[model samples]
Target chain A: MMVSNDDAALVVERIGPQALVEDSGRFGVRHLGVTQGGALDWVSLGWANWLLGNAPGTAGVEIAIGGFALKAEASMTLAIAGGDLGATLDGAPLPPNGAFAIERGQTLAFAQPVAGLRAYLALPGGVVAAPFMGSVATVAREQLGGLDGRGSALAGGDRLLAAGTCAAPREMPMAPALPREDVALELVTGAQIGHFEGASLFATFNSPWQVDTRADRMGVRLTGPELRCQLGGMISEGIPLGAVQVPPDGQPIILLNDRQTIGGYPRLGALSPLACAALAQCAPGTTLTLSPITPHQARRRYLATLAQWR
Target chain B: MSDAQIRVSEAPVIRLETVGMDALMVRLFDAIDEAHMPWILAADRALREGFGEDLVDLVPSYTTLLVNYDVERLDQREASACIRDALIGLRPASTAAGREHRIPVWYDESVGPELPRIAERLGVSCEEIIRRHSERDYCAFALGFTPGYAFMGMIEEALATPRLKTPRQKVAAGSVGIAERQTAIYSMRSPGGWNLLGRTAVKLFDRERDDISLFRPGDRIRFEPITRDVFIEQGGDTTPLEERG
Candidate 1:
C-alpha cells in the first residue's frame, strides 16, 4: 500500500447510532481528570490490527450495533474483526475475522448485529485522526479525540485517512470463539469486597445477572440481587477500568474505558481484562454470571491470551 | 535508596491492593483530609519516577492513588514490590509546594439559577450567600468528573448544600457549583446536578496552554467576587440560565 498526501482512503456514507476511532487508550494524565478513552473490546481491536500487519495499539474504527456504511475512495485491503455485525461488501455478505480487498466505488455496509454488539474495522495502516493527549480514542463526554480532535462520532460524509501504508494482509489462522451461552465474567475481588453481606457475596457469584439497557462506553449496569454493603458513606477514590461498583441501590455498575476517574460507591471488585472484553460484546438482556478469581490467576490468564499475538 | 533517607516522623498507614489484572491502588487513609495531599503527591511522584516506561497512569484522588501499569512488562508481585520500595519510608512532600489561585467569579441570580433558591432555603440574602462562599479558601481535594474539573472543598458548613434530585442536561462551561462541601467549576459543558453559585471567566482547561489544566490536585483556591462588567471584560458568558422547556 502507498499513501498520497491529499487523498482519503474511505468516506463515511452513513453512520448508525455510534462509531468512534479508538486506540489503546489515553494514559499518564488521569490526575487531570481525563478518562481513558479506548475501544471497549480491546482484544478484538488487537486482532483487527494484527490481521492488517499493524501494531496492536494502532487506532481503528469501533462500529456499534450496525447501520454504518462506508465507500472506498481507493482500492485497499481492510480487516474486520470482533462481533458478527451483519456486514456486506457491494451488496454481498462479507464474513468477518479476515482481511478483504475492496475496489474504489464499492460500498461496505453493516446492517445489524448477528451475534455481538460491536465490530472493529481496521484500515490498511490505521485510522488516522489527530491525537489528543497522545491518543485518538474518542471520548464524547469529555470532548476529546476523533477526526476533529473534539470527540465527535463518525458522521456522514466524513473523510478518513490512513496513518501509514501497510505491508501485506496476513491470514488469520484461529480466532477466539464468540461467547453464546451464559457468559461467565471472571472478577478479581478486592476493595470493599469484605463490606458486602455474606449472602450478597454468595448471590453475586451464584446468581444470574442480566445486562441492563442502560449500558454504554462509560459503564454497564447489571440487574441482579440487591447487593447490600455494610460500609456507609465512603470517601471517593480513584476508579479503575472494570471496577464493579455497588451503589446505594445495590445494583452493580461495571466501569469501562470512559468512566469517571473517581467514585464513592462500594466495589465488589473489578472484572479481569479478558472478562471485560467478553462482557463488552454482550447485548442488553444477555444473561451472565460472575466467578471470583485470584489476582495471580487473572494475571496468568491475561499472559496466556497475550501470547497468542506472537 | 537508604531507609534513613526516606524515613518520616509520621508515615501514613498504607495499603497496596490489586485492582483487576493491570492496576494497583495505594490507599493512604480511610477518610478524606487536606493533610493527605502531601503524602498522595509524594507517592504519585515516587511511583511515576520508579515505574518509568512501565507506568500507564496514576490517578490521585481523596484517599487513594491508582497506578495503572503495563501488565505484560510487570507482574503484580513485581509491581507491588516496586510500589513498596518507592513508598516504604517515603516522606510527605511539603504542604507549601502547591500553588495558590484566586479565581474571579460573578455571583448573581441570572447565571447562577440556584442562587435565589439557595438563599431562600437558608433564609439569607443572595449577597450574604456570596460573601459566605468567598470568605474562605478551599483545598483542591481531587480532579474528576471531567478533564480539568477540580473537586475543591470544605465549604462553610452553613453553605453546604445537597445536589439536585434531577441533574441539568447541560451545565455551561465555567459554571461554578457546589454539592455538599465540594465546589467545582464545570471545565466543559456537561450534565451535572451541582447547585450552581456562579460562573468564572478563567479557563479551567485549555489544550492550547502548555500545562492544559489550571489547577492541580493539592492546590489552594480562593473565590473572589467580581462585578458583571468585570466578568464580561474577562470573557465570561453573561447569558442568563434558563430552564429547559
Candidate 2:
C-alpha cells in the first residue's frame, strides 16, 4: 500500500497530547551502533495493523499514557489497539481493537488512561513518514526515525498524513481479543541464570514483583526483594529484548525494544516473546511472577502465535 | 564438505532461541571479543545472501545476531534450517579486513581538557602522551555504544584509563577518547565518561550522507594532529572535546 501527496490526510490541529509515529524499528544498522527504536508494544501495533488490513510491519502512532488529540482534514479509516485510554472521536466514545471511519474535520481525542500505558493508532494503509536506516520508528534520543528522519517527537502544528486511502472498515472478531488480566509471562533461562543464588532463584520464581514507576521504552525496573547472584565484574555483553538483568542494586530491569544494544550486568533470564508483549501492556505497580519454560516450548508457542497472525 | 563436517566445525558461536512471536536471536558468544567478529560478519553476510527475501533483517551486535523475518510467511523450522544452511556455506570475506581512515585531531588544551590528568596518571609529559597515542595504528573492533561510534582496540598500555568515576552528563560529538584498552570516537553529543584526549572536526555520523557512519567494524584508524585554525576551518567548535563533536 502506498500513500500519495494529493491523497494524504492532514492534521489540522491537536487537542490534548501529541502522537509520535513508529514502525517495527530500524534494524540491521545496530552494527553501526544505532539503537532499535520502535513501538513499545509490538503485539498491540501488529493488532492495530491487522485490524486496518495493513501489514503487521506498517507504521502507526504510539501514544504514551493517552491525552493525544487530532483533527482529521480528510476522510480516513483508523484502528486503535493496546490499552484502553478512553478514546473519543468528535465527542463520540470510540472503542479499542476495532476500525472506524473518521470523517474529514472531525476531532479525535484520548483522556488519561484508565488501563494500559500506551495506545497504538493505525491508519488504513499506514502513516506516511520518512524512513531512516529502513525504519520510521521514532527514537527521540538518537534523533533518528521520524517524519523528518531526525527522530523528532510529535508536537503542536505537526500534521500526520496517511500513506494510503482507507478501504471498508474490517472487523476483527472478539473471540481472539487478548485477555487483559492475570497474564503469565514466560521466561527462558539465560546464560547467567545459574549465577543467581539458589534461594534467590527460588524467590525469583515464587515472589510477586511490582512494576516500578521507573519504566520507559528502554526498560522496566521491577521492585521486589533483593536477589543476590554469584557473578561479578561481568564483561559488557550484548543484551537481547526481554533480558532480565540485575544490576548492583539487585532489582531486575527487563530490557525492551528501545534498550541499549549492550550491557554489563548479571542476567537471570529472558522473557519469551509473548511474555514481553504481555509485560508491555502492564502498568506500573502491576504484580507479575516469573515462570520458566524450555526453549522448545517457547519456540513452539511463539511459532503458534505467528501462525494465527498470518 | 558434508553436512556432518560443517556441523562439527566450530560449533555455532550463537545459540538460537525465540525472542518473540516474530523475532529470533542467534547469540554469537557470551562476551565480546575480536575472535568473534569474523564469525559474526560471516553469519550476517551468509544469512542476507542465502535467505534473500525470506529475511526481514539481520541485526549483528557485539556477540549476537537478531534475525528478524516475516513471521506470516515463514515458520521456525524452515527459517532455522535456512539459517543453518547459510552458515554452512559461509566463508569470511577478504573485505572483512575493512578500510582505514586517518582522523586529524587537535590535542591541545583548546580541544582536550582531560589530557593533563591522563598524562599525570601515566607519569609522562602531555606531549609524550599525545605522541604515543598518535604514533600507533588502531583496529576498529566494533561500531557500537552509539550511532557511528567506532570502538577501536589496544591503546598504549600506559595510556589505558578507566572511564570517569561518574559519567559526564553529555559528551561532545567527535570526541576521541580512551577507556581501558578500548578507544572510541563519539559520533554525537551524548553522556559518556571516556578519558578525553582531543577532538576531530569530521562528522562521524550524518544521516544525510550516503555513508552515514565514518568508521565501521574492522577498520584501521590513526589520529593526526591539527592546528586550532584548521580545526575551526573544518567546522569544529572551540569548546572542550566533551562539548564539541
Candidate 3:
C-alpha cells in the first residue's frame, strides 16, 4: 500500500546533534570493509517497534542525546522507546514503551536525555528508505544507508513517510529494565584475554571505569585502570561488535557496530549484546564496571532475553 | 605430503574459540606470512559456503577468520562443530581462482608528496622506486581499516619504510602507500599513517557498481605507472580500472 500525501507522517521541525535511520543492522557485507550500522541499543529499538505493532527488526529512527523535534504532517500511530529524552506531545508529556497517536499539526519534541542516551521512534510499517547493503542502518563515516542514502544524520525539512493504518496502542511483551548508575557491563573473554597480566585482569574486573567523551558509534573509551598486556606487537585481526580492545595506552575501548573491521590492539574480550546495549545508554562520565562471564553463560542469557521479542 | 598427512598436520594447529554470542574466531597461524594467505582464504570461502545463512559475516585477516553466526540458530558447540567439518572439506589454495587487476598509479612528487622523501630514504632515484614498487604482484590478504580498502601486501623489501610519525588527518582516496612490506591504495579519504608513494586514478570502492568492492581476499593486484594527463582522462568513476595485461 502506498502512503499518500494526506498521511505523510512526520516532518522535521528541528534537528538534534545526531539522528539516523537504523534497523536490526547491516549484515553479510562486513567482508567488504563496510561496517554494520545498527541501533546501539537494539533492545530499545525492538521495544519501539513492538509498541507500534511493527516487526521487531523494522527500521526506525535513533535520536541520540535528544534535541530533536518533529511536527506531525498527518495523523499517525507512533511509538518511542529507549532513553527518557523528555518527550512531549503537543506540550503534553509522552512516556516511552507504549504506542500513541499524533493528530495532524501536533508536534512531538525530544528535549534532552532524562534516562537513556538514545530513543527510537517507530512509525507504523517504518519510514520509507531502500535498504543499502542489505540494511537501512546508517553509518556516516562510510557514507551508506539512511534516508539521504549518503549516510547523513537527519536534517530539517526531511519528511518521514510511513505505510499502514493506525491501530490500537501496543506494548512490549517483556521490556528490559532501564539502565541504572554504575551498571556492570558483562564481557566474554577472547583470544588476547590470556595475554593480559593477571593484575590488569583483576583490575579490569574490579575497577570502576569512567566513560570518556571520546565515545561514538565506532567505540566507547573507558578511562580508568591501565590494562597491561604482554603481547608486544600484534597483527591486525578481525574485530567483532562489542570487542573490548585494550590499546597500548592501557585504556580499553569497546568496539561497536561502526568500528573498523580489524584492529591490532590486544583485546580483553567482547561484551554481550545486552550488556553492550546497557552500556550504550550510558552518557559520558557514567561509571561502569566490567564483569567477566563465560561465553556459554553469556549466550544462554542472550537467548533468554531475545525470547521476549519473539 | 599425502592427503592423510596434510589433514593430520593441519588439524592439530588450528585453534577455534567462541568470540562472542554471535562469532567464532578461528586461528590459522601464530604469525603473519604469505603462506598463511591460502589457508585464510580457503577457510573463509569454505566456512561461508558451508554455513550459508547461518553465517552472518566472516572476516579473513592475515591469519584468522572471524566467523560471525546467529547464536539463535546455532550454539557455541554446534557452530564450532560446523566450522571444523567445513575445514575438513577445504582444498589446496592452488585450485582457488583469485581476481586480477592492473591499477594505474600516478607516481611523482607532484601527486605523491612523500615520494621524494621515500626515494631519498632508500637511496634510490624516483624512477627506480616506481619501477621496483609496480613490478611485482601483491596479494590482498585482508580487507579492513575501511570499506573496500583491501589490505594488499608483502611489497618488495627494498622500498619498505616505517609509517609517518603523525598520520595525516586526511589521506585522499586512491593514494598508494608502502609501509613495512605492504602497499595499499587508500580506498577512501580517511586519516592514515601509511607512507604515500603515489595516487591511483581508480576508485577501488564504488557503491553504484553491482559488486561494490573491486578487490576481494586472494585477488592479485599490479600497479601500473601512468602519466598525469592519462590519470585525469580516466576520471574518478569506474572508467579507470584496466584489465591486467
Candidate 4:
C-alpha cells in the first residue's frame, strides 16, 4: 500500500459531479488587470487545508455539487472538508471535516450534497500543479490557473498527483457544519447606500431574495424586489468583490471572486466575507435575507471567525 | 512613513469603505474627470510604496482604487488610516503620464463595417466620417472588459455612435469600435456591442510581446488607415497575442 519514491502519478477512477484543482487564488497580477481567479468558497478551502495540517492556502481540489470519484494509485492520507456533499470511500460512508487514509487502488466517490455546494479535498501535503500568476486556482474563463496552467476544469480521464510525502494517519476532531439553508447574509452598506430610494432600501433589508439561475464565479443574480436608486447616469467606478450591483434591470447581482475589475452600475452595498462564503454554497432558488450591520461589527465578526479557524 | 513631506487634499467625493474582511475601496470622486485621474494614480502609487508587501493588490479604475490586503496582518482601521494619510500626501507632480501609442486602422468599407451607418446617422459622407475619426486624438481612460482591452475616451463629437442593439457574439481581434463617447480596440475575440468602424493589422495585445498591451490609461491614440491587402500581408490572423515578455 505504499507508493514508490519514483511513482508520482495518481490515476482517476471516476469523475463525479465536478472537481477542479484549486489554491488560495491568483494574486499580484491584478495590476496587469487580471482578475483574482480563485475558489468560489475560499473559507471552506482554507478549512480543508487546516484539517490536513497543511498551509491554509495550499492547492487542493474544489468539488462543486459533488459527484466526483477518484482512485488512488498509491497509499495516501487525505482530508475532506467544506460542504457536506455525501462522500464515501470503497462503499463505506466517510465523514466530512476529518482526515483519513486511502490505500493504493482504492476508490473515493462523492454524491449529491445534503447541505452546501462546494467540498474540498486536500492531500497530506498539497496538490501538485504549476502556478499561473502565483496560484493554481482554476479559472476556466480567464484561461489561467489550473493543473496544466491552462484553467481547464476537470474532465473524465484526468489524473491528479499529490506533492510532498504523506504524513502518518491521524484523527482530528471534527467541527459542527454550519446550517447552509435559510442563511442570512450580512451587508455593509456602500457609499451609494443613501442613493437608493427609502422603499427600496427597506425592501433590500426586509424582503427575502431568491438566488437566480444566472450564477457563476463572476457573480450571482438575485431575484427580488427592484431596488431603485436616486442617482441616475452616475459614472462607472471600480467595483469590489461582494458589491451588490443594481443594473438598469433593477435586479441585484452580487459580484464574486472572478468579477471584472470595474463596473458602472449603482450598488446598494457589499456583503461581508463570511456572508459571501455562506452565499457561495447556496443553490439557485435558495432564499436569503440581507441584514445590515456597521463596519465595526462586520470587522469584529470576521476577525472572530478567522481566530476560531486559526 | 514620514509625515513631513506628505501634502493633503480633501477628496470629498472619494468614499472609504470596507469591501470584505480583507479589502477596502478608496473610491475617487463620484464621476470621471481629467483632474481626478492624476489623484487616483498618485494615491495608488503612494499607498503601494507606503505599505509595500502588506498591501495585497491595488486595482485602479477611471475614478476608484480598490486596495486588497491580508486581514490576518492588517485591519480596516490601520489600512484605512494609512491610505487616507497617503491620499492627503498625494501630489499631482508624482503621477507619470501613461505612454501614448499610435495605432494604424483601415477605415474603408472592407475594414470599417459600420462606416456607412455612422455616416448616414451623422449626415456626413463616409469619407468625411473616416477623416474626422482619424484626425482626433483619443485618450485611454481605462482598461477592462477583457485582457488588453483599452477603453479610450472623448471620441469626435460627430463620429460618436451608440453601441449596436444586439452585440456581436464574436468580435474579431484588433477591431476598432466606438460606443457613445468611448472608442476601443478589441484585444481578443469576444462578444461586443460597440459600433465597429475599422480593424487594425497592428496587434493591440500580444502576450508574447514585452508590451502586451499597446495602450494604457492616459496614453494618446491616433488611427491610421491602410488598404485590405496590406492588412492580410501583415500576418494578422487575430489570434491572441501570446505572452512573450
Tell me each candidate's TM-score. Answer: 0.95, 0.87, 0.94, 0.89
Write one digit per residue (lDDT tens) for candidate 1, span A10-126: 999999889999998998889899999899999999898988888877899999999999998888888899898899999999887888888889999999889888999998678
Clashing pairs in 3: none
lDDT of each: 0.87, 0.76, 0.83, 0.74
Largest DockQ belongs to which candidate?
Answer: 1
**Docking quality (DockQ) of candidate 3:** 0.66
lDDT (Cα, tens digit) per residue for candidate 3, span B115-206: 88878887889998899988877888789888899888788777778888888777778888877888898888788888877788787889
- For model 2, report the TM-score of its A chain: 0.94
Maximum-lDDT candidate: 1
Better of 1 and 4 by DockQ: 1
Each model's RMSD to truth, in Å?
Answer: 3.6, 5.0, 4.3, 5.4
- Candidate 4 residue lDDT tens string, B120-169: 88788988887888776666667777766777777766677778888877
Q: Which residue runs does candidate 4 get wrong by more than 4 Å?
A: A1-6, A13-17, A169-172, A308-310, B1-20, B93-96, B108-112, B123-127, B201-214, B238-245
Indicate the docking level reached by candidate 3: medium
Q: Give the TM-score of candidate 1.
A: 0.95
Model 1: runs farther than 4 Å from truth?
A1-4, B1-10
Sliding window of 10 residues with minimal summed lDDT for model 4 chain A: A1-10
User: What would the per-residue lDDT of candidate 3 be over residues A133-202, giving only the tens digit for each residue?
Assistant: 7788888888888888878888998888885655776765555577768788999888678999999999
Give the TM-score of chain B in candidate 1.
0.92
DockQ of each: 0.72, 0.34, 0.66, 0.41
Task: Mark the regions of model 2 whose C-alpha exceeds 4 Å error after superposition.
Answer: A6-12, A15-18, A175-181, B1-96, B241-245
DockQ of 1: 0.72
